[model samples]
Target: MADITGIPPQSIDPDQALWPNAGTIRSSNQTNAAGQAGNAEKPTANNKDGIYVKDRLEDKDVKPEKIIFSNKLEASTYLKLQQLATYGGENIQEILEAALTAYFVGKEEASRPLPPKVLAVLRKKYPFL
Candidate 1:
């Protein structure tokens, strides 16, 4: 499988136009009247000269949480649920609950802890003692 970078290029017909206007194609190096490229990169919220929040690190609203997965199957299922949530206009929590319900309905063993090595590492890093 190809490395995860961005969207992979799909095979399309060369004769058919990709966009709405077939003839007119916008160039990235398009210049204005002053002979300078009008396509200037705007600073994002994370950038130094950004117009948005000056210090995102100091922001109280950015409450980041970590979600630990047991296996690749669970991780893949969670990713699918996330996509489903986005497409179906449902919240992630709702999607996750629905997925978990479906998953547990047929399964006998519901609760399973992380592997010994993983648990040990996690315990060492984030000790309860």
Candidate 2:
């Protein structure tokens, strides 16, 4: 998956061209247009630059499986959330999940106390319902 470009085919030695059209290997004294000695580093599997296709593919595989979750919050609320995260030694996402879960649970418990018909009957029995 390595690719090298900008080399003329005829200049490559037959034995050194391990495969057809492999990149040129310059003699020690040869200089590129920049006048730098032709000591260009060869791309390798462990190179961090990802100049080769395989290196880029491997990088993709090694990346963390996380997605960006963006939202806007009031300044005060955002500050409170950040403080809670710092004090509790947990992340904002965890705190938000717990808070939302508790809120829904409270709503469910409130609903469990009475059906609408029963509440209406109670309201009729006591005007101050």
Candidate 3:
């Protein structure tokens, strides 16, 4: 389609096409150019450093600024999650929260004090441990 200035759409500059972050999303915080946002669910409080932080689990309804990248596996997982949410008649955000909670719970468990046997093996394998 022709734009108002009668310029036809063309491919992005070749140099930009191969740039490392070409497909990466940028947040407004990274730029001096004032940006605008639309009606996303609002976020909660901010720290003295001006970053938003949700203090309560109930604040899940409040949207926060973030970015995520996906490959085939992650994209497939999200698609399956979306399907499950549709089948269960639930919001995708709630499903996402459940998934995040499960992931973190595993992480927390993995962080607990290791058994003496495991620690001995690890320490033997890597003296820095």
Candidate 4:
């Protein structure tokens, strides 16, 4: 992947496009015109910027899953969501997935308990201190 294939479809100055104009890569805390400091540096497989793409951090291919949204968000809200995603260096899909997952996990943890047999086994394996 490191091997550059000629040039990209559009000319990209890595320093200008992704990095600061400084001679070397600047700190993640450095601010850009978009005002995104890229605070979180959990690297992804693609590793575009330092900010974490919660879903991509696992180094797994993002399976293309299609689902239709009701598109209920107001236009301004949608734009803000896009801007936040861009500024935070997150994939919008991953952000949504993380939100959905957290919601479901929270509900599941509260509503669903493991079978008594499993709990017993765990208790036996490691006694409560």
The TM-score values for the models, in the order shown, are 0.28, 0.29, 0.28, 0.30
Better of 3 and 4 by lDDT: 4
Better of 2 and 4 by TM-score: 4
In model 1, the clashing pairs are none
| Worst lDDT 10-window in candidate 3 | 32-41
Q: What is the overall TM-score of model 3 with all chains considered together?
A: 0.28
RMSD of each: 16.2, 24.1, 13.9, 13.8
Better of 1 and 2 by lDDT: 2
lDDT of 2 by residue, 16-96 (tens): 545331232222232442342233345565565546643344433222343324689999998887656545545555577
Best by lDDT: 4
Model 4: residues with Cα > 4 Å off, grouped in runs: 1-70, 108-129
**RMSD of candidate 1 to the true fold?**
16.2
Ranking by TM-score: 4, 2, 1, 3
Backbone clash total for model 4 is 0
Candidate 3, superposed: residue stretches over 4 Å from native = 1-73, 106-129
Query: Model 4: per-residue lDDT, tens digit, 18-121?
Result: 64432221223334423433443454544676544643424333233433244477899778767665566655666677877788874757577778998788
For model 1, the stretches where C-alpha displacement exceeds 4 angstroms are 1-88, 113-115, 124-129
Ranking by lDDT: 4, 3, 2, 1
